[model samples]
Target: MGKCSIKEAYVRIENGQVYVCNMNITPYEKGNIFNKDPLRPKRLLLHKSEINKLAAQTAQQGYTVVPLQVYLNGSLIKMEIGLARGKKLYDKRQDIAKKDQRREAEKEFKVRNLY
Candidate 1:
């Protein structure tokens, strides 16, 4: 299914190809018996040059390919990925705090608008 949670996914290079793993794609409601594993690895279709570039970049120490987003272009679906370094505990905590602040601000904005 097109609707999926790619937050837990990471990229892997195998046999000169790119694969995204740990993504959870929701199963189609009506296709109950035919549903595939939601957590299966999915391959990314890219040009040879692009794959080579990604492979080279990810070969660096502590660098990994991260899936940023998924979107549609006309009838074809595309995934956006980038090379990223692992985040430290402090950085993760800061990000969580920022997200919480944004959420609280959004809540306040909605409450003020309800007058």
Candidate 2:
């Protein structure tokens, strides 16, 4: 299902097709030395339907999908990707506003509950 412990990801466009690739993870341990030449390709397992959907998106002129996250799930590693169409400036602003509102509401609720 997975190749190794994935720490990061990168998206690349090759031949007009969008592909997500795994970035090497270097542990920040004292004895460990970071290797810059450790780039390797990792295979992603997805449902046939999902692959078809991604294929369709890639075929489009201005649409591309990319990996958003890669993390450990129990002892297994899982990757999460986005079927993204580039967001407009307003969309980003709206997302920030919504997050701020949610955070403020949570803060108010927590403050009111204090004895």
Candidate 3:
């Protein structure tokens, strides 16, 4: 219902568990009966082995876990998360240039196939 993005979200790791913080989930407009707080922390359901691995990786290296997508699978809601490292300005520029080059190559291939 409102604006929510990665800029407003972050992850918190504590007590051998992972908690997603600062994420907003807006409720329905028609009725406010079953609505909860929008900015509540949502605990992620991960295995013990996975949690330990994530904890170790973050401790030794400067990596952060970020949620990539939230979607429904069957009747359950699933979340996809990824480990991310901050990129410098130069790194970002290089990535952007590479992406543009790949896009151009794909476009050229499509045109060639059409003819």
Candidate 4:
């Protein structure tokens, strides 16, 4: 799955169907503005069979479904969904430490390259 920014998007489930809700795709500046509304959110439908299977698994394990990334593949838009469980305080601290370590490593690499 690719990483991308989704400032205003959410996952929605209705009648056992999964959807990417409130996803805003900006209209082309030179395109016909009157024909499209930029403020309107585009609802993306996910594969029903796959989503159903994942939902069943996550439900049985007491995990929640969360959208991790949103991106476009050619003409189709895709969302990466994940089954997530709530993290404990120590888990959060461990994650933070890992992130910090990675960041520091990157910074050191950049500095070494400059020499």
Candidate 5:
């Protein structure tokens, strides 16, 4: 079975520590037995320079740091963070309409080719 999707995802920074909240990972079958639980959120210990950079970026008005993706890179875990601002309601609606148009176009294309 596939892993369940996370409902609420966010990034939290406190006292120079970064954590990816509400993220879940499957436990490896042949992994170490004494390893911490994979389901629990782990603190990402970034370099001092990286921490300072993220802090500075998030300190600006209307900008917040968000974790876009988290995955295992080789034997180490990695997270991709982005600086993002909240979207307006109209912008969200436009995005939804674009998605619907693209989906409809794909459906039409599939039907045309299925003949």
Candidate 6:
């Protein structure tokens, strides 16, 4: 059983404090169900300045801050935060096509087995 990083983090503004809610850890993504806690609120690590910036962005309507990945970087757990607006349908389709093309190119690459 493997451990799960954060699946998702939704930022919320409550009483002038930046709060992250709805942290879900799924076994499907984590590889197995070991000490699974689905509805736990994990504390996010961010500097005061970064938190303030995220808080400000979230305060504005239609702006959001989301955690995309959580990984152990050099003995410390770090979360990659993104301040992003919602993407449209066309944008998502373009992203999918780009990914498919990249995968296809990689698949066509030849590698010599020198064993």
> Candidate 3, which segments miss by more than 4 Å at Cα?
1-7, 89-115
lDDT of 4 by residue, 1-115 (tens): 2433456655656677665555555666666747565445445466778768766766664466667876688987677777767788899999999999999999999999999
Number of the top-ranking candidate, with TM-score as the measure = 1
- Number of the predicted model whose lDDT against the real structure is largest: 1
The superposed Cα distance between candidate 2 and the true structure at residue 13, in angstroms, equals 9.7
RMSD of each: 4.5, 6.4, 5.9, 5.6, 4.7, 7.2
Error (Å) of candidate 4 at residue 26 is: 3.4
What does candidate 2 score on TM? 0.48
Off by over 4 Å in 4: 1-4, 7-9, 22-24, 27-42, 60-62, 93-115
| Cα lDDT for residue 105, candidate 1 | 100
What does candidate 3's lDDT look like per residue over 5-68, in tens digits?
4456777789988998888877667756777777889899999999998888777666888888
TM-scores for all candidates: the values are 0.74, 0.48, 0.67, 0.49, 0.60, 0.53
Assess candidate 4 and give its TM-score to the true structure.
0.49
Q: Give per-candidate clash totals.
A: 0, 0, 0, 0, 0, 0
lDDT tens digits by residue: candidate 5, 1-115: 2353344656777898987777666666677887566557668888989988988988887787777766667887667778889888899999999999999999999999999
* Model 2 per-residue lDDT at 46: 66
Deviation (Å) of 68 in candidate 3: 0.7
Under the 3 Å rule for N, CA and C atoms, how many clashes does model 2 have? 0
Predictions in order: lDDT: 0.91, 0.65, 0.82, 0.68, 0.76, 0.68
Tell me the deviation in Å of residue 3 in model 3.
9.5
Q: What's the lDDT for residue 3 in model 4?
A: 32
